[model samples]
Target: SPPTPPAPSEPEPPAPPAPAEPAEQGQPFAPSPAGSAADLGDAPSQFPNAVPPTQDFDDDPQGFEQPAPSRKSGLRARPVIALALVLALLAGLVGGVVGFVFANRVFTNNGVNPSVSLGSPPPPGSSARPADSVAGIAAKVLPTVVSLDVAGPSQSDTGSGFIIRSDGYILTNNHVIEAAASQGSITVGFNDGSKATATLVGRDPAYDLAVVKVDKKDLPTLALGNSDDIVVGDSVLAVGSPLGLTGTVTTGIVSALNRPVTTGDSSTQDTSFINAIQTDAAINPGNSGGPLVNSAGAAIGINSAIATLSQGSSGSGSIGVGFAIPINQARRTAEEIIQTGKSTKPVIGVTLDIRYTGPGAKIADNAINGAAPVTSGGAADKAGIKAGDIVLSVNGRTVNTADELIVAIRSYKPGDTVTLKVQRGGSTQDIKVTLASESTTK
Candidate 1:
């Protein structure tokens, strides 16, 4: 089991008061040249004659004056005004004819305007996207994707998940809901704006997967695809609530596959080893447990961790590199958790020497802890694997580190037989082993 998170610390004491400073002086205000009447009333009595008195222009000797026209002069101007009106009417008639002729030439059937009728409006439904298009996939997948708001004793978080079963079973990353696992709350927000309280069904920390259930039934679910069918450079879309932006989708290609990714605190059971499908899709803090779907809109992986340039509690954004748990593995773990309250992890029953700096993972010559280095009658022991044997590969895949070998084995279920390329002394040979199951309960 993972260790309980530490309690939040008390806040620091307030800083001491600063030394006193002299009071600030106000700046002098300058009055406008044309001051208001209120300003004149408030002015000092000694400045009563400051403004010059108003002068009347009616008796000014320099003013230019004109007399009104006489009645006989006005009668003479009327004939001239009538002749000017008659000329203006004839000019207006000529201008109207010219304007009409110009308009008739420009607006006729031979004009550019008539040649530019809107391109026959596209056939109805022509705007619809192809079924395999990104938009089409998003349209089909968004309703199945959901946002998770988890409130715990010390902190709160938001992540993403998707409906897996019509009866309200949801699949999400274990870490997304781990904070609220003990005496907290989980709220599921749907794309349709509906929300419901959820109860934890089960979780496997080893796989970093958890299943939760709501009270509702007949909910739409996303279709699951075979992760094994995924190849490099295949177009994929990551659908999730990244940074709490619900129903967000990003596009990318499968940059790599079968990447061994180990995360979480190694000292506790919270550690997760994944045979991850690497992608360049933007996966961020809140995108955990969201689906990485193919062009067909079928989910092939679960968006999990992201590679960042910085480390520690200070968060960072995606750097074009992201990893997702293969849906094949997630499907198995999810099915097991739904059936039972827990899931199992595949183990080879041999302790690896972590300190060995070699080409391949080397088994410890002796036990590191209290347990034996090799379990008697276990899969590794039964396959004739001895202590200090370096494992070069699982099946045909090369494993350079202990984590690589562990994740490669974890990709399979219990009782599956896999061939291991092991080197003992100066010789290397192939050994077949049937993997064993260990409960992930603790």
Candidate 2:
């Protein structure tokens, strides 16, 4: 069976958990584990560039639910008692010999261990050794990176993010802070072990992007690179906190691009869709919202989610198949978010037949969810889009499914006119549709 949006399974807990506030009225609430969904919202994920993607990846947010620490019994266990007995016997036999050796060596080393020696300092103008290698890039980039500790009403989640502006504007995945929106807070920790409280600047769930601001001066920021310039097999680095370990860095190459994915909690039936940049980096649950930096220490993509081993994800970490939101898409969304309280999603006024299961997205004969198949006097309708017309391509880019069409349109901004290749009545014709915001199109 084809996988739907990510909400896979609830855990068989070591013990029953305490109840918490409901996400919605009449809904029971419990914390979820990493890469799992709690709300059940679904979103379509886009691939990088114009490469057409084939499948939907229900990428779950990392560390969905962190279990409570285990409690200890009052009594000592047999294992501890047995180890203590063995240690007692060994101590009596070796204590005098150990003391004699330590006393003699402590003075013979001239008050400092002879093995310790000062090495030559790094060359001037290049404090980072091998300045062209991945280690060098990490040395420069890590200072701009941060580990986010988001506290929710019920649980706290860990994820990664990077500074985009020296004024301390940081970008991260929306899901990383979604739970914190209500009665919660986020603390940003830096590579230097210093931490600061952050406030939400803006968020757009449709794009799975969020911008948060910290009150700090002279902060280091990462340089943004053009995602369009990246190619397959390009060297990339994924830096973030995975499993609560901060400043973790992994290296890999671009595996594929323009992969269409829809990930979120299926129970909520709400999700995000996108065309993603695929890489084989060791991205684990806590790696979400981190930057995927190019060889030059520029951010090319925002590390988002990793695909699990459905009988095959390697371990609890990444399976070498991780997906990132292209920085090109993130750059646009971030600007709009910072400028406005929310970002707009581009949409063509047409209801697609998702069940058509054809080569290209097929327009439904009538509207679904009370939306008009062709919005009256709207972009598509005005551009001569008719019901039952099969859309073959958008601006010359092939769209294989309704999800693809949606993601492709979102790759652009509202008011951007794009050409569409439509097939109707056994004939193919080019049509132009100026996209409008989903908020206004209906």
Candidate 3:
């Protein structure tokens, strides 16, 4: 009690509070400096477990202390980082230059882009044709084919032909050179790019054939084959200058035989009757007079006409139906023209009754013209073909009209025997007659 009286003399100014403990291990805290009461009044509280206002706390809930980086160490690291950045930039620059150079070398050729590649060519003779192949036959036949150009006073036309004699005797259609026969010119063009003026040796409008001669020797000629040997389905090639296309070659098969074809204008006497060899070859207007060859490259027919669906100046192209003059008849007519400058037509020596509209070709009962219905001592009269008789057939081929009978009779050469089925009043009889030759004139 006496010591108490000594009184808490100057209660040692509440010993400054201890510093707060760090929230985590290794964290340190600093205490505020001693100050007067007034000075410390505005200052943070110095109580234990309380933080000083001057001190900063970590944002982490569990306070973690990060060491302050040294200024000297930061200065030293700045140069190292700058050096690394500079090296990276230099490396990028060098890589870009190398890539540009490599790309240039790979895509450029003397500063020009390369052309498209098609690979190497095929080996020679890999597509060689046999001797009997179409190519081979064309090679052998093309040289013999000739193009005919005719120039008339009012018209000019072109056709095709083939060599028939080595002395430059060429065979063509009468219609081809007909315009030139009177007062025109005819020029023959060879496959070898050579040309010659041709003179008409002979022409037969009835047979639609002609022969032209050129002052040429050793000319290649085509071999004439027997048309009788060629039946239906036989392979044939038609060579001509179609549409003025020189050396044109087309192939097909024999479609029919003994087709009666009457061509030319009926108003004129130039009308021709032909026992045609029908084929599916592509024949056009310019193809007239060209050779229709067999598989052996032998001339079997002469391409003469094409059947068209329409007719006019606009004209028409091929529809695969073509007619050719049988080479047998052509041969006979050609021979006669060559030997005597004329040809002949076989006749039965009877005038047809054009008014008779019966089922068969009829003979006139009386003389319509000044001539007799049946010529005396001629083929028909000698064979007992009476006037007013109807010819039912010729050589086993049916004849329904006067034209059919004429065409059938003309199909045979003169002096050839033919059996004609004739219908009289009430009897039908087969009469054998030897055809007589009648000369044809221009």
Candidate maximizing TM-score: 3
Superposed on all Cα atoms, the candidates' RMSDs to the truth, in angstroms, are 34.3, 43.6, 9.1
Candidate 2 lDDT over 1-442, as tens digits, reads: 8868889688876876556444443222333433333223322132124322232223433423333233333134666988999999899869978987987776574576666669988776845577559889999899999999999999888898999999989999988987786669999999999999999988777778889999998999999999999999999999999888899899999999888877776466446776899999899988999999999999999998888766664566677899999999999888887777677788787888888997889999988889778878878988999999999898989988998888788878889999999999889999988887763100
Candidate 1 lDDT, 203-301, residue by residue in tens:
888989999999999999999999999899999999899889998999999999999998888887589999999999989989998999999999999
lDDT value for model 1: 0.87
What TM-score would every model get versus the actual structure?
0.71, 0.69, 0.73
TM-score of 2: 0.69
lDDT accuracy of residue 428 in candidate 2? 96
Rank ordering of all candidates by TM-score, starting from the highest: 3, 1, 2
- Provide the overall lDDT of each model, using Cα atoms, as 2-decimal numbers: 0.87, 0.82, 0.86
RMSD of 2: 43.6
lDDT winner: 1
Total clashing pairs in model 1: 0
lDDT of 3 at 88: 100
Once superposed on the true structure, which residue ranges of model 2 sit more than 4 Å away at CA? 1-127, 266-270, 311-316, 439-442
lDDT of 2: 0.82
By TM-score, is 1 or 2 better?
1
lDDT of 2 at 286: 86
